[model samples]
Target: MRTDRIFGLAVVLGALAYIASAFQLQTSFLSDPVGSRTFPIIVGSVAAVCGLVMVVSPDPEPDWPHGRTWARLGIAVLVLVGYAYALRPWGFVLPTALAAGIISYQINPRPMAAALTGIGLSVGLYLLFKYALGLGLMALPRDFPG
Candidate 1:
């Protein structure tokens, strides 16, 4: 089996699991109009469809990454995981900026640009989520800037 097909199969299986788990989410009368399970189910469904497409028509000559690229990929995954853990304690901005900075620097290898990208993306996403979407995300920790 081709690597892409294997990856696609994994994605399909993971998406199925995600969808199944989403069904387990308990909602109340006070839940949002879309409900808590809706987004996860939609995301899982989309992922399943994309995975099926990849399984049906994978790249004939997939140029797999090598050497430092693999390291960078691993680092990016670690950063994201750390970001998830740090979100509640550190709030949104600081951890997000660090994670985005590291990942952006890995992609571009430019310190200043990466810093700008990190700060810009962190603030942009914060505003978009908090203000535009009316989501109550903490911009910083309660005692921050003191």
Candidate 2:
């Protein structure tokens, strides 16, 4: 029940889940030759290897919980869940910006800097995923004529 053991278990479980999900993915004639499952398989393998390494390694000293650590983690989880739920409704830009802002707030308490950083991250990610990766994530509300 040590932190290292817990982390190792988490990694193993994550890997297993990834692998299982990949196995469950259906394929079609239009699917890429490598298929969507390839990356997940690779990731799961890497995670399993890392988990094994962590399990074999000596445990590190555990740090006592800081007052804000749990709060920060909660904020991070909220941001991630919000992003998932808001992606289609709010589109890419606003939800991404909000998520980035929440993450930045945890990293730095300065409001102005966090806001700017979030804007930069949102724009940058939009360009990266939409242009470079050809993801075509909508940047605005669907009904807006813009």
lDDT of 2 by residue, 9-91 (tens): 78988899889989999888798779988988998999988987777783785876687898888889988987899999888
TM-score, per-candidate, Cα-based = 0.57, 0.56
Q: Which tens-of-lDDT digit does each residue in 1-146 have in candidate 1? A: 39879999999999999999999998888977899999999999999999999899998856879999999999999999999899998999999889999999999999999999999999999999998999989988998877
Query: Among all windows of ten consecutive residues in candidate 2, which has the lowest summed lDDT?
Result: 58-67
The lDDT of each candidate is 0.93, 0.87
Cα deviation at 61, candidate 2, in Å, is 7.1
lDDT of 1: 0.93
Best by TM-score: 1
